[model samples]
Target: MTDGVPTWEEIARDHGRFLYAVAYRLSGNDDEAQDLVQESLIRVRRGLERYEPGSLEGWLARIVTNVFLDEMRRRKRRPTDALPDDPERVLPAAPAADEVYVGLSDDIQAALSALPEEFRVPVVMCDVADQSYEQIAEALGVPVGTVRSRLHRGRKLLREMLSEHAA
Candidate 1:
């Protein structure tokens, strides 16, 4: 805790990596993840005073998620052309671990990206961000049962997509 004011820079310094993880899992790209984190920081700064003490990480993750969802809504309203990309240009550097495992994560991200926003948000909140059903429900303004069903369906779809890619 620095002097009196809780600066966004301090929050970014402490929680940037976690924010990046959440953003990356949601957006599936480095640039979008960075933008999401940046936007979340801005929102956090505006609301920092009202921020409660417990689960700061959770609060930040929720902000990132909200920002991402808002962008998705805006994009839907103003559809843009998606430039075709060369596969080579899109691929990430190889990870240190098993190639198959790394590819699986990429596959999961692709599948997650393809899911409906409702399913995708809950699944990422519960599975990727490690939030509980109650937290996910609250963040999504839904019930626990709704969150559970969405997560279940999301995981099932992800499995099917990954298996098809493996074949």
Candidate 2:
């Protein structure tokens, strides 16, 4: 935090978990979250000079979100084929037993992932990233009212989904 601007390493060391949590909430997949964090860091490094002093995490959240949206747009433009689910296909290796999983429950994660992007982004930004509606609105280029509306709708959807799952 020298000169009111953190070095790249300092940002990563201090805020990596925060970045990853936001990314994971947005993407709903570990691999995609990792990629989002990596891309966000790259963007942060490049844009550091122009970054203002207030709310570094907010800035990082915006970067990660933009990266996720860009990738979604790119995927839409050039959609990939899904491989057939074969019964005998080998699954990827599991995480180490000692590794901690500090995320939403599987059912909650699925419900959140099921949300449309318009709703999900606001929910993740407001809840997962702990960002203010004004900050989210500013980052998303939407009105604060819109952020509130979407967040409300998104939470409603999640509640319905989770209740159904519980039933």
Candidate 3:
């Protein structure tokens, strides 16, 4: 056995469902859930050479968790304004006051997106990511108190948003 470890495909068949569950909770949607799991598997495969045999499952779990968070981080970034496929043509640049702002228009989506990054991060870490608050504290490089506060604030914000949206 290489490094005394089982093969990746074997372990994946055994554990893929568990990884999918983690992604499903974080994404709150089936399509994105599947994407998270697939991305996680890709990351695991990419880094396989560096993994220690004893840490196989742990490494895989971390990869899955990071993929979910990376999605959220990317969602927060401004989307590109350029249409990259047109290599031979270009449009005239707008004047000094023009700026493109692109994002979700629906109130519900906006509300979720508007939650403070700090609050949303801890809630997802503890709830959707299925990580212990202590683990979240370690991963976030923050005190447990900070994690607790963020989680509480996040839940409160969601409650308010949902109630408002339901009206």
Q: Worst lDDT window (10 residues) for model 3?
A: 95-104
lDDT of 2 by residue, 1-167 (tens): 67799977889999999999999889987767888999999998899899989998889888999998888888778665223256443353364453335544777778989999999999999888889999999988999999999999999999999998888
Cα-lDDT of candidate 3: 0.65
Q: Model-by-model lDDT, in order?
A: 0.81, 0.86, 0.65
Better of 1 and 3 by TM-score: 1
> Candidate 1: how large is its RMSD?
4.4
Superposition-based RMSD of candidate 3 using all C-alpha atoms, in angstroms: 9.6
Residue 110 of model 3 has an lDDT of: 45
Give me the runs in candidate 2 sitting further than 4 Å from their true place.
Answer: 81-104
Of the two candidates 2 and 3, the one with more favorable lDDT, higher being better, is: 2
Which has the greatest TM-score?
Answer: 2
lDDT of 3 by residue, 55-138 (tens): 454455567667867766776573443334576435433423322224332444446456776776567566645677777777
Which TM-score value belongs to model 1? Answer: 0.80
